[model samples]
Target: MELALGELLDERLITLDLQATEREGAIRELAGLIDRAGKLADRDEYVNAVLAREALGSTGVGHGVAIPHGKSPAVREAAVAFGRSRTGVDFAAPDGRPADLVFLIAAPEGAHDLHLKALAHLARRLVHDEVREALRQAGSAHEVVRVLAQA
Candidate 1:
């Protein structure tokens, strides 16, 4: 079956109130979400992969959004964790705007790039101003999932 954003982004993985102040903290917080959902076999290993990717280049793709992803054996399944920061976290975005909307994609090491596909799908949705606005204003985890499901 094809990967679907609405399915991969389980509502249990969405957080409307992110408490991180920086990039790594934000990523760890999101990873914790995925781990709690039992999608990660080894949270540290998965987090290391993502931070390593960040070292190569910031995942912050501008427009107040950041998509951080990793492929590792630690991933039990392909999952997407969503977090929204009211105060915004500094993700070193190219546009220099703090990222308020963050997506953490976890894909298994030999899953043939599922994370990349999810990242691409989300990127397409985020380019629309209305979608971003809807996420920023989402009142609950279900609302956030609804926006992404429709977007």
Candidate 2:
């Protein structure tokens, strides 16, 4: 099945002010957001999986964006959580700059290939300056969703 970004994103999963100043802390915060949304069956396990992925390579794709993701059995469903930090977080981005936008993606273990494809699509859309600017200027979670929907 093709995964739709709109179906995976929820306004409640968007956080305008992230409190984390570091990578791990940022991942934890985003994981907590999805967990609170009832998307993770085991929050710790899911977060650990994402951390493990980070160990392999930082997901900080630069341009002030970090896409941290993992496929694990702990995920109850495939979902994405969006967060923005006004102060920026040290996500070990390839460009060596702090990341202001974070997108944490959780996928069930069985959906490995699908996850990759979906992530690719999201990455392509995120590369557009217009989309990035819109997300940055979004005033509320609803506004964030609207911006993403337009992408």
TM-score, each model? 0.97, 0.95
For model 1, how does the per-residue alpha-carbon lDDT over 23-103 read when each residue is reduced to its tens digit? 999999999999999999999999999999999999998899999999999999889999999899888899999999999
Least accurate 10 contiguous residues by lDDT in model 1: 1-10
Model 2 lDDT at residue 129: 97
lDDT of each: 0.92, 0.90
lDDT tens digits, residue span 1-151, model 2: 6557888899979999999998889999999999999999999999999999999988989899999999999999888999999899877888988899999999999985866876886888899999999999999999998888778
- For model 1, how many clashes? 0
Roughly what TM-score does model 2 have, to 2 decimal places? 0.95
Candidate 2 stretches with Cα past 4 Å from truth are none
Write down the RMSD of candidate 1 (Cα, Å).
1.0
Best by lDDT: 1
Off by over 4 Å in 1: none
